[model samples]
Target: MIARRKVLLGGAGLLALGTGSCAGRRMWLDREPKLPLGIDAQGRALWSNWSGLEHAYPASRAAPASEAELAMLLPKAQAPIRPVGAGHSFTALVPTQGTLLSLDRLEGVVSHQVITATVRAGTKLSALGPALAAAGQEMVCLPDINKQTLAGALSTGTHGTGKGITAIHGTVTALRLVLPDGSIAECSRDERPELFHAARVGLGSFGVLSEVTLQNRPLSRVKKVVRLVDTDWVLGQWPALASQHRNAEFLVLPFTGKSALITHDVTDEPVRPRGPDTDSQTLMDLKRLRDLFEFTPGLRRRAAQMAMKNLPEEVAVDEGWKLLSNERPDRFKEMEYHLPIEHQVEVLREVIARIERDAHGVFFPIEARIIAPDDAWLSPFYQRESGSVAVHAWYKEDHQWMFKLIEPLFREAGGRPHWGKLHSLCASDLAALYPMFKEANAVRRSVDPAGRMVNPFVAKIFG
Candidate 1:
């Protein structure tokens, strides 16, 4: 404990002794790379992910208006046909030189039966929420960001924070996929059980999901509350806190020694919609603190504590769909891992200590959320309930430190990387982490024997 305090104090003291000029600080903090041209040398239009960290110039780009159109194009398109959703992923999964397939035209709810809705895979969650509401249904859980397509979110095993709530893939009852050979297949627990489990979290390597049937619940309102709390206290009480709320998560402010605890619970209260977002403003404030006080660690800590302490809690009540998902205009590259429930806090503590002692430029808060277990073959939360830790770097920054420092800690704690996020694990490493990795790979190979769906990144993962 004394050593940890010394590290924190040492960081602040260095900031004080090595104070740099304001102009120099501004230049350093705001520096960013110049964006490339809209079109490449061959005149192929440029394509980039949400964070602008990954891009590719595909030889051909196709937007299939219907499943029939996709089926006809998949077998003939180039070797390594890749599907592009909203391009929200930070990894190289979407980058391919062969073919970029867009499902923009094939969207919306295809059909509905009581509590279940069969929606086209291309439908965006932002649009699907209202469509489901119109049909008197809503997804049981949704990821914090609603920009992802239903298929993309499921493929990546995206999730929201909540007790007893699994990732979106858990809600999938059936799926229709177009194999690399231009053949279509449908899978459910009752039919093609192996394929059902394997392809549910396929990471876009098994096949392209064309349609999905989700088990939804009746639309309802929820109350959301966000409050600042002492980081140490919250960390100690997290397990109990999580169990007490319907949905719960927290964001730990790196230098301030505090965290924002956010929770959502079922409520029938009158609509008291949330106000304009202040998250971006708060993030910038933290960055400014880093920039201005890099040389004065003590002053930085005092200033942050003074500014954040006693702030009023944010409260809102509205339909669960609207309040649960957020519109994240700011872009950042991320690395997240889901670990065994018991080790989450220990790993988080070590990571925070490492950052305070070493990574001085990091301003983004570390996000902590819990997830119930699921049966998806590649799911990080396979058989045991999980606690996920996600660290992010601003889009303009380099995340090499994440791979060098933090990833090793997570790996040591029996963590599994989020498929669409940054990680250094390969096929052999992943096989050791997941018990069903071999089975999933076998299913993928049977469907895509010619390797039409395998890009260089996917090859490294599935080799």
Candidate 2:
């Protein structure tokens, strides 16, 4: 955690004292956000996303235990049938006035071979790690958060960081999908190739995924290292850093002029297991700093720099899976876009400068990552190496600034928004960005002609 003692040192102590007067107001802002009623007037129960940014009271909820059960539910249960996983998505992809189907009961590893594993779509990445480890195998990559189910992660094109690594969907060799009209279609590069290409990152609109086959690697240990460095230095050195490490990513501390550079690589060193996570506490500390110095950028930057100045780097050696993903207890709304690799550094520079200049109430660190290209038709990283930039706001605060100030930059750089994150793009805008958009939509129509799987948000996206 950012050292609180160091933050209170010297002249910064006065600013901390001054904040006491506004305690009542700040407390109100810090309180849990007002929630929607548990039961809506229609008598439907509430279902909300992890960040509480999106919610709905589906007319019915169904958890299917097997492919047969899911196939039976899809055709006749309701129109606009939507499948939900861990509700990790910030967008309204899962909300529906009709049936809300869940795949939680359909979890676990189905089978495995030397370098591949077939898994139930509902298996959480958390459970998948150990299950795969038992077979001496592991996923080629994993996203930053592990709570999301296999289906959710793949559908949204969720990814991890590395120069050569692709997103989770890129590792998929085949999939079994339960279509809207009670038919099952098993697809891969050779069998039903069009469907496979279109639905790999289909955003749940193609159909509910039942099973997935992943090309995995032998389970191995990796060393993780994290250090704080000047933001400018990181910006200049990012390309080399990304190439040097097996997995590399960084968090830019807004207003602080510092960045946390995290890297991981295969190692034979003795296990030095990661300690309890201090990231959440450190995040809240950043929030406190924001509250205290919303108007005084200099002091906020100085105090943060002081606290972070001499802090020791954090290191751990563990199985790749355990160290690759993290626990994110603090809820926040996010907007992320994947851009052409060459424009990443220039875009990041603008993002940081813009946040520091105008988005004063922001305290969340900006995340930067790299993903190699994939053949998944709807994937943000499709056909080109990409670098991703994500911005966040506390769940209780307004995130409109991201759309207003940051999204334009992303769009102008020929970026594509992460399928499940916040974005304002419609069908036309997306068509221009994705070369295969029209063909993918045509494939979607062929499978679900009646549009039984389309929700309002999906409609806007697939028009």
Candidate 3:
């Protein structure tokens, strides 16, 4: 229920008292974590993900400027040739000891034809928006974070929220991949269809995507609305809300008995550009509340409820591309799963109850969204409409509770883990979740017979 302005004003007083003698120990326990070595003993530089949970010191790094250069380097580079984007993923997908392949130099809009644009795999979603807008086109869907490269987004099945909108890979009509053997392969529904299906959500195991053709739509304006509401009411009305809006999602504030409902719809209204970000400060405010009242659930709920009451709704009119994705500056570890749409509400109820009952140290909001199904063999949403639930922990806090308390619920409900997020499932578990898992792994093996792209994590996933 806490709005940006109100929380800023109220937090100033609470924060001052929070640092006093009574809460001094809590502040010390929440300080920044000790950093890893900047450079290892073997002279390899440290490469870490955004959350700082995953890192590696590869023996070599390559930034090839052109497809020709990338293809030429692939066959002979060090083993476990891993491609890295912006390092936004929390999982171990990007960490490798042999070679860190960067496609940063091979980025831009390659070509356009009305509603379609061929983009370089290294093009970040942030840059791709304006580039596509210049041609009067935009992607059909975009993930919540725009820092990831096109290849990274597609490979990991990144998605946005909507009733019928699929993940980013669903819009990919065709793609060019540079195989481990240095051979270039072009695939689509009509050409090499098997490879197309297997590699769309490839997790960077089959090969590195060089270029992708996206099925897009005309650039248009949209209205975005954010309102605070009772968590139970929102949960009951979610199906209707999702169907009514162009896009819809919600954030659950644990111990607060409230949630933020966000929706977007196509609009023709005059532009009222979005305001500066207040989400980061609001998150920190929640953390402050947790630190002060962690031992008293009743007091925590009352404080948050009192602060959030009767706040004004926030609205903005802008291009869909600008409004959909967000800038997340604070770092955290996350675990997310996509489950059958019918099971979402029930599972979410359990998640919230479990967290509120046991995880008093939790302060980050739980996120929920809906995604349409796609045919990509490895995609979590394959052949079934899915509603996703994500739980987070501040980077410096312990995340073992997610695996111990939440993962079992997801597994029991037949949920599939997000490829880029945290989960404990292995190849056998995955094989049961995805109907095409065996075939996808076979295609991966055929393309990279020597396992040149396989890291320890990838091996565990494909075994």
Greater-TM-score candidate between 1 and 3? 3
Better of 1 and 2 by lDDT: 2
TM-scores, in order shown? 0.94, 0.97, 0.97
* lDDT per residue (tens digit) for residues 1-463 in model 2: 2212232243455546547755445777777889999998888899999999999999989999999999888988877799999999999999999999999999999999997999999999999999999999987589889999999999999999998999999999999999998889999999999999999998998899999999999999999998888999999999999999989999998998998889999999999998878777777778878888788899888877776668778889999999999888889999999999999999999999999999998998899999999998899999999999999999989899999999999999999999889999999999999999999999999998999889999999998
Using TM-score as the yardstick, the better of models 1 and 2 is 2
Error of 1 at 3 (Å): 33
Per-residue lDDT over 112-146 for candidate 1, one digit per residue giving the tens place of the 0 to 100 score? 98889999999999999999998999875788789
Weakest 10 consecutive residues of candidate 3 by summed lDDT: 1-10
Pairwise TM-score winner, candidates 2 and 3: 3
What value of lDDT does candidate 3 attain over all alpha carbons? 0.91
TM-score ranking, high to low: 3, 2, 1
Model 2 alpha-carbon miss at residue 62, Å:
0.7
Model 2 stretches astray by more than 4 angstroms: 1-18, 22-25
Whole-model Cα lDDT per candidate? 0.86, 0.90, 0.91
Clashing pairs in 3: 1-308
